[model samples]
Target: MNESLLGALRRAVGEPHVLTGDDCAPFLTDWRKVVTGRAAAVVRPGTTGQVRDVVRACLEHGTPIVPQGGNTGQVAGATPDQSGRAIVLQLGRMNRIRAIDAENDTLVAEAGCVLQAVQEAARAAGRLFPLSLGAEGTCLIGGNLATNAGGTQVLRYGNARELTLGLEVVTAEGEVWNGLRALRKDNTGYDLRDLYIGSEGTLGVITAATLKLFPLPAAQRTAFAATASIEQAVALLARARSMLGAELTGFELMSAVALELVPKHFPDQRLPLPAAPWFVLLETSDAEGESRASERFDALLSAALEAGEINDAAVAQTMAQSKAFWHLRESITLAVAAEGKCAKHDISIPTSRMAAFVTTTDRLLQERFAGVRSATFGHLGDGNLHYNILQPKGQDARSFAATQQDLSLLVHDRVRDHGGSISAEQGIGGLRTADLQRYEDPVKIALLRRIKQALDPRGLMNPGKVLPWQTMP
Candidate 1:
């Protein structure tokens, strides 16, 4: 059966593209290196027609198909299971910018197009594709849409779902659904485009997307500020929103510990302000020139300082300085990985209760797990916190890693108590299926299961992800 399926895949996407043995190793592991699996073969398909043929071949043989793009997901959603009975459907070869309608402010890109390339294409067209992420250079648009990624700019432009108008998906049955309408107001039936999105490939494979674009900002201002506490950071966010309004594009909150890691690991990255308990990095885009942007930023920061919302602040005076400020923020993830084993939680809480939640969670963690350091930060404007807990200094790495489940459970329990979601920007990939079952409402879970059964009855679409294997028929 494995040989038959491999033969079909090879025929569909060429023999050279059907990788086996040592060549398949790269696609079997996840980005975080937390979980590794095995696959029968790794198939790279270059076109939607090839994707459809691969899906059909897998379906005919009753083989599981794990759709993968860029393999940059935090969770193990793109990895296959240990059975070695499935094929990793890699989509990196299908990268292409199909079309760009500047008048409609939309760009159609293949699923494998790198996000940074898409942004550059939009810039070349005198427009802006506002989905900015730390991994934009490597992460593909399909994965971003599959996970509904939320980046720093989400405060103003919203997540990937909002930025996307339509999708070209190859369903579980190998049928192409061309719902790639660029219309802003389409009152269609079921909204199938959204159904496939954020599904993590459980329902279908996102082959391409029609993404919305906006006019390039005349000027963008970047600022970094130090705050005494999370409360002050939240207050500062409120002030920015009130004064800057729509111009405020990004607002990120970082712990002093999180920032300290950047300079500790990278050594070249410098902090702009003195050490404090918390810091905020914000950006504002003005349709008007730099003069207007500078004026608004000055008013906002000055008011924040006067009200004691911030202890100190520094605004970037040049484009190089602005990129430097953002680089520091983006470097936090790599710094955390370099530190040691981490129990990471991507959670979202109401901005109103964010301060209390962080304070209480920190205290509870210290009380229960002695000396577990918190390296926390994330998009404060959109209420998504990358709240990560690092192993204590001088602790046994394996022992500390073992406590990941318990640590995450406690944090997620508190998240539920505070009316927050356990999984925020990162979808419930294979890593959090158990957590999803634990924290999610039963009714919602039942509905999700039903949708899965309805869309992919054979359960061949990325099995053991988002929904547990035991729950599937």
Candidate 2:
């Protein structure tokens, strides 16, 4: 039966595109290398019709399908299971900017299109896609939508779910739903597009998207500021929002420990300011000229310093300098990874309670597990923090990693107490299915399972994802 199904898949999307053995290895592991899985074959489909055909073949043979894009997700959502009975659907060949309507401020891009490519396409058309992330260069737009990604600019522009106007999906029944409408005001029923955006391929395969665009800002300014504490950093965020208003595009908070790792791992990257307990990297996109943008940034930072909200600040003088500031912010993840095994949490809490939550959680972890270090940072503007707990110095890395479950439970329990979410920007992929079951309301989980059953009745669409398989009735 497996061989017959593989033959059908090869027929649907040519034999050359059907990958097996060593060629399938690359698509099996996730970005973080935390989990690896097996597959019968990796099927590359170049068009929506081909995707439909592949799905039809898989469904007919009762084979599970794991739809994968660039495979850049932090969670192993795109990775298949150990069953080896599934076919990994690779979408890289379908990459293409189908259309760009500058007047309507929308662009249609296939699921396989690299995120950076879509951004470049929008820029060439005198528009902005506004979905900037560290993985934009290699991550696919489909995966971004699959996860409903939130990046530095989410404070102003919003997440991928808000930026997407429509989607072109191939459903579990091996049928294409062309709901790619560009209208802004559609009194539609059910909102099926939204249902699939963050569903993480459990419902259907996202083949392409109709994405919203924004006008390119006239001038942009960036700054890196030092703060005495998380409280100070939060205060500065409030001040920036009040003063800059809509112009404030990004506000990222980084711990001194997080920043310290960059210099230790990459000697070339210099810290712009003296180390402090906390730091902020912020930016503003002004409709006015460069002079006006610079004036606004300078005024904002100076007021922050004088008001004692921040210790010191450095405004980027040029675009290169601005990129450098962002580079430092982006490098935190790599630095943390270099240190060794760590317990990571991507969570969001009410901005009002963020400071208290961090302080309390940090103290509790210290009390519970001695010498565990916190290397935390993230989009403070949107209230999402990558609160990561690193293994203690001189401790056995594996031993420290063994306590990850307990560490995360304490942190997530605190998040629950503070009115926060366990999974923030990152979707609850396979890695967090158990976490979802633990923290999420039983009613919500049941409803999600119903939706999955209604759409993929055979339970073959990316099984063991978003919704846990064990608890499914």
Candidate 3:
């Protein structure tokens, strides 16, 4: 640890808020428990101005800064490299609900506010902030905006980028760039906010945001069903949309292996299905209240049944029942973790090619790695699928992870073949940076590098993220 950097950080944001020694353990590891890195200190600033000053000092000292929100990101976007010269700019202390406009249906919140906290505040004010995700309890709004996060409600309310009206950011040069204008439409200049949203903090430190909100959904409905295959789930989703239209809010698909592991890990939240090839969880929301929502939902399920899309199904009879249905879908994370060793590939393809993609990947893994247990599931409506594979019984976890590169290539190449993306909701962090260079086109990669150079000339903002320093020949 550099004594000079520590002194600078202390002078900028007080000495007590700067974490050193063993106190920095919690901020060192990412949420997935995959990658762990070291940092000189964790700087917890209480306000946006303090963040600007801290960044400026780090820039002057030629030190790296890892801007962190809730540190709930699945990827190690917030984790620094082995070099302990970097500082973890912890935004958790800057939490505040800046303002809530009931009439405009917009919420101004600091970056450190928990996602669920933002939602609760909106609900209390008789409005809705629809950027819903499984990590709502811990994921911070800043990280969501930083990654342009897509959640279950993306099909209805769009991702965090769309829902966000403005931003307050600290640039790499330690300048406070305030772009917070809460307007519904602005055709003046480039959509600069988009550049920072999914850039994974490489571009800047997102301090706060003005997020758009929506009317409270008066009616809500949920359904869980068994599908013969991924094809059947896709068919049912289209059918539901034809009937429910924009009211369709969430549609998640689950695999038997993924669901099976859920009961194994979270015995309390098990689904009744013993063995099924595939499962689908669909939900709908409307502004008419929960009354008659079940009837409409049941009708949709019946229609899907007669259409031969669903082999078996269940509709929630009440709000409590609806919550339980979602609980089952959200349990996929725990389920995968319980399955021993697994590799996660966050990929997306055109909805039309999903069945073919799933079938091919499953067959390929079985042939290449004997005894490998694979589970394919996630938001089918949006075409983003979590095609994760559990390692074969005899293989060591480390050995299997070494083959992660080969596995990711096999999966991502197929996705690219099908006009899909290797990364969907998950942003490009340290682990994915190498693959981003490997798969991304030359022109696109070059443009990304230019953007990085333009904003972060010194490459000190969030080092070792987004794009790789080297590329394949």
Which candidate number has the best lDDT?
1
Residue 393 alpha-carbon offset, candidate 3, angstroms: 2.8
- The TM-scores of all predictions, comma-separated, are 0.99, 0.99, 0.97
Weakest lDDT window of 10 consecutive positions for candidate 3: 464-473
Q: Rank the candidates by TM-score, best first.
A: 1, 2, 3
Query: Per-residue alpha-carbon lDDT of model 2 for 1-473, expressed as tens digits?
Result: 37788889888999999999988999999988899999999999999999999999988898899999888888899999998999999999999999999999999999999999999999999999999998888899989998999998999999999999889999999999998999888886999988999999999999989999999999999989999988888899899999999999999999998899999998889999997899999999999798898888888888999999999888888899999999999888989999888888999999999999999999999999999999999999999999999999999977997899999999999999999999898898899999999999999999998999899998988899998888543
List model 1 lDDT by residue over 116-164, tens digit each. Answer: 9999999999999999999999999999999999998999999999999
Stretches of candidate 1 off by over 4 Å are: none
| Pairs that clash in candidate 2 | none
Clashes of 3: 3
Q: What is the TM-score of candidate 3?
A: 0.97
